[model samples]
Target: MTEILLLNGEPLHTVTPQLLRATSYAHFSSLQVRDGKVDGLDLHFERLDRSTRELFGRSLEAAQIRAVLQAGLAHTDGNASFRLTVLDTDLLLRIEPPIAPSTTPVRLQPIQHQRALPHLKHTGTFDLIYFGRRAQEAGYDDAVFHTAAGEISEASIWNICFARGPEIVFPAAPILNGIRQQVLQRGLAAYETSPVLVSELASFDAAYLTNSIDPALPVAAIGEVTYAPHPESVRTIAAAYASQAAQPI
Candidate 1:
């Protein structure tokens, strides 16, 4: 499980202070590359393109991104966790060991916070990391962010969803539209996008978080409310995600 770093299409050997500072103004998307293919590959490209346009006043071509991803995969076994970051117009590809979906349910501590640019997956993650560490220090798995008015937005680095019977509810807040969430919503039979209040969490049958790495991770508890295990729901969600066709890079 060797890690490979590439800037543009060339190898990145060292990280100077200037390079580190330049990368702070970047936005990135991560995906698990299995067998040199990626599920929701188009969505990842769209995310990077949209973020680049909005953040840098320029568009990044999907073909260019695909080329960099392919270059990075060529150095690996074609199975790894890959991240494509846009530092202005430059592309930074990081390939690392693949991550499997979590089997254990996560416990989240609700925190009052919001990301600077909620729509884009930008590099300003100081609050996210800080709150996550505080939650871990307090014996929780991670932190779930909520607006000052108590509207649940998202978790530290994942999108949050709640289940009520056969319906999947996504909180209608200013948060990043995660690629996995978009794919799951498309495959789901019944789903809703609405404002979810933290106080109303107890009414839900189950809770879970989704990201590029973990598609459907059950939430055992959030704040003081606890949810019973819902393995069937998780299986259904995973099936929907797995049913998607993986496109070659």
Candidate 2:
């Protein structure tokens, strides 16, 4: 929610927020800032370092990360986001945010057999990397992208969250794992997502989406998929976060 601008190692008093309160979900990077604060900064950095190694066959030393961040800080002011991106050359660099696009929580048409490469928090979905434009033209916010086997993968920006009877179910879609997913795992809550059919939307209690920037919100509807908020699970997650923050950093 804050903007820090730096032009070539010189800091600016302010930088316009390209996507403040906006949802483009196209930029390729993890969300370091959460609600005006950086979430699990150390963990994100560690993952960043590791993901580069995993995906690019290279590892960045802590010194390298610190150097880049220091360089970035010199150019940025307070409350700014740090973005790690791969340019057209596939060479990674620290840059300002990406082009923000229109975002809408779309009712998804379930697709089948889509595989996700879950980059351990680096790459975007394989489909987004491949066939996402069609989803937009179909008059849906996005596709509730599923695996070729019909297992739910995720949305363009988040892990697909489904509310069933009394719990939140997150199927094991490792290919699309991101930062928020790790946070949910650390939080004690009753949720499970098994292999499911797209037609099973009728039986879901509720649905929502999650990414690093937004933690949780009940789904309004998903192409006739609807339900009330799963209060208990929400409360459990809220309490878990409160307890987590109150602990020593």
**In model 2, what are the clashing residue pairs, if there are any?**
6-75, 106-141, 112-148, 113-147, 113-148, 114-147, 114-148, 118-175, 169-192
**Candidate 1 weakest ten by summed lDDT:** 230-239
Per-model clash counts, in order, read 0, 9
Error of 2 at 141 (Å): 1.3
**Model 2 lDDT at residue 136:** 59
Minimal lDDT window, size 10, model 2: 19-28
Q: Residue 29 error for model 2, in Å?
A: 3.0
lDDT (tens digit, per residue) of candidate 1 on 161-243: 99887678999989999999998987887689999999999999899899988888889999899999766676767677777
Each model's lDDT comes to 0.89, 0.54
Question: TM-scores of all models?
Answer: 0.96, 0.69
Give per-residue CA lDDT, model 2, range 130-220, as digits (tens): 4456665765656666766666767666677766555667766544666666566566455675765566776876676666656664555
Error at 183, model 2, angstroms: 1.1
Index of the highest-lDDT prediction: 1
